[model samples]
Target: MEAYVVATACTKFEKKPNQTFKGLTEEVYLDLLREAELENGDLIGQAWFGNCGMGTFGQRNIRGQVCFTPLVNKKLFPERVGIINVEGGCATGSMAFHGAWKDVVSGIEDVSLAIGVEKIFQPDRPDMIQEIYDGGIDQFDKDEWIKFYKDVGDQLGKPFNPEEKKGTIFMNTYGLQALWHMKKFGTTQKQIALAASKNHFHGSLNEKAQYQFKVSVEDVLNDREISYPLTRSMCAPIGDGAAAALICSKKGLKLFTKEVQDRAIKIKSSVLTGGKYRTLDEPGLSRIAAQKAFKQADIIQKDIDILEIHDATSFCEIYQLEMLGFCDDGKGGQFVEEGKTSLDGELPVNLSGGLVSKGHPVGATGLSMVHELSVQLKGEGAKRQSKRHKYALAENGGGVIGFEEAACSVIILQSPF
Candidate 1:
């Protein structure tokens, strides 16, 4: 059983919620459906929606249905459209896609829509920051959490000790993992800066990227430090955006055009796994998910043509590259320095600027990755197209409370021969 993406659309991240969830989603669906030449009435099947900032947007459950049903005359067949809400910190979008793909593959639905949208910009920056933190903040002893964050920060050399703040756990668990990698592999801050620089350079060429300016490694290194060895440039900016993709089975593909029919990109593998809650060790879910995807796709790591990783920070990208078997452990930094992940390198990665430069709208980030890969496969990636893309991989991780992710999804896509 195979599923293919027949249409896709995404909105640019804006500081203000100029477009409400309903407006943004309707626009994306209209555009994508138009491109696929599918009428609104054709989309009567189930849908998997991913969104962060629901509370921020003042929306209730099944946000996608509520936002899109009106556009299609409120005739959405309730029996046909089973809505599922997914929350995976920054990987919400990718998680939604995984859910939709599962439904189609399992014969639960012949066609399903996977959409990710987020609106974080509120009236106050502090309020928005609080909202973002609230998504990951554990409901344990608030003071203890704050103290733990402060200790983590102090150990990482961060200036602000969050432990002093009430109910604030500023621990970016990944920071500790990153520091470990640096200590063991001799990975330098300069190498991480280089990765950020590359992302910005690639992002500058993308019209949809929020930040279009090219940055230097020095700029990334010298920028204000959020965490030890992580500067502002190394972090992903929160913004507002939406991305949508229509997934359908082989039977449903007959409704599309011959061009789309002939150029379908099959879903070779889609794997979602949760973390093992183990700190200071390799993420079991990431490893297991990668293995499952590889086996399902019938391709090894060496055969992957391009990859879009959940690089919330430069180190995250490096770690995932190593963990996914793209390179040996402790050698990811050297791999980046060698230009192995560059556009012209042996394995191009994050060709669409990634979350670093692309603006991670949490829920929309995963779908954005899928959209970029699909565009690249179709030779429609305008400016960020890779040299060769026979197969593409996307890995999205979210909700970092401790050492492991709360949710993670890995998808393998291949251009049909």
Candidate 2:
């Protein structure tokens, strides 16, 4: 609780086919400096870098150095600044922020930096973009996910396509899960489309979002299906971006001027956990992580004024809503239907559009979520700013294990003022 995200920034989440991962990271750093009013990068004590698809491009081994070399050299920072490259499937950015938070909370460093960057779109080698599906699994066992999808197809009496390597397997699983939820709880496609419709409206307000155009629930339902019932408009697009946050201790906040301190958002609780195997009727890791975070923050879900969840698909939005206790079991669709998660609603969720509309570049998503929360809490969200920004939560998940996320992080933030 001693650490606070005093400053945060991110590049526009979109397809920058010509940009390198390193270049995107530098842009975020520059934005971070401008936001924090810090003239020198040397003030940073340590850095945690997050990236998910470095292997697809190059430099898989020395990823830390490959991304932040001469650009963040000794001239602007420490002679031997510690840098750690991290991969947490999609929650990579939040993992880096967690690492830096520990550094500051432990009183080992004054100012620590966490940055998550990823380049998933390659104009020439479009096939390489499929790495988003492969990056989470064991590279040694490449056929594992494919076989699962093939089995799913067989179960449904549908043919499997090995050449169907365009999108992420996450969607395939999400689609399957959506079917199960609909059957078990009588969830309708209209309910899921409502969530998508709300986010599309949110996206229209976010210039950084990949798809900024608004669509009606009917439009989302009628759109081309990615995996039946899950329309293309309901899924997150592949893109490239970087997001950064500066974590500082209470004493470190003194190092900044009063204006920055006033704008700081306190980290009340942060919980990260790996996946736990579960049956169809059991709880998943994401739900467990959220319970832990809520207990740590000493607040219930009703206290959250704003939320940004990893909505890879419209179903994911509903699923996570229930898992995170925003609504009763099998009632997430109703929650969205009632407009409880809109800007004018009591708890505005995903005001920055979220992954489905804002674009998901894997490693950068979690921190981008945090960046949105920071801006809202600081009353700097401009037109999209919610009147209720006192308490916020961000839930980001990565990879998959059976029916659970391989890794998940839940963070709660409180306005310092």
Give the candidate number with the greatest lDDT: 2
The digit string of per-residue lDDT tens for model 1 on 1-417 reads 879987778887656546687777777777777767766635547777788787655675767667766765754234345678777777789888988888888887777888887777665566665666577646665565456545645665643444333222333554565776787688988888888899888889888888888999989999977666777898787678889888889998887889778777789998888764464545546777899899999999988999999888888878888878888888889899889888888998898888889888888889998888988888777677887888999998887555557678899999765
lDDT of 2: 0.85
Predicted candidate 2 versus true structure: per-residue lDDT over 1-108, tens digit per residue:
388998999899888988887789778988998888888677789999998888777677778666777565735445678898888999899999889988998899
The stretch of ten residues in a row with the least summed lDDT in candidate 1 is 162-171
Local lDDT at 328 for model 1:
85
- Taking every candidate in turn, the Cα RMSD to the unseen true structure, in Å, is 2.7, 1.9
Which residue segments of model 2 deviate by more than 4 Å?
A: 141-166
Q: Weakest 10 consecutive residues, lDDT, candidate 2? A: 158-167
Clash count (model 1, backbone only): 0
Model 1 CA deviation exceeding 4 Å by range: 74-80, 123-125, 141-160, 163-171
Per-candidate TM equals 0.92, 0.95
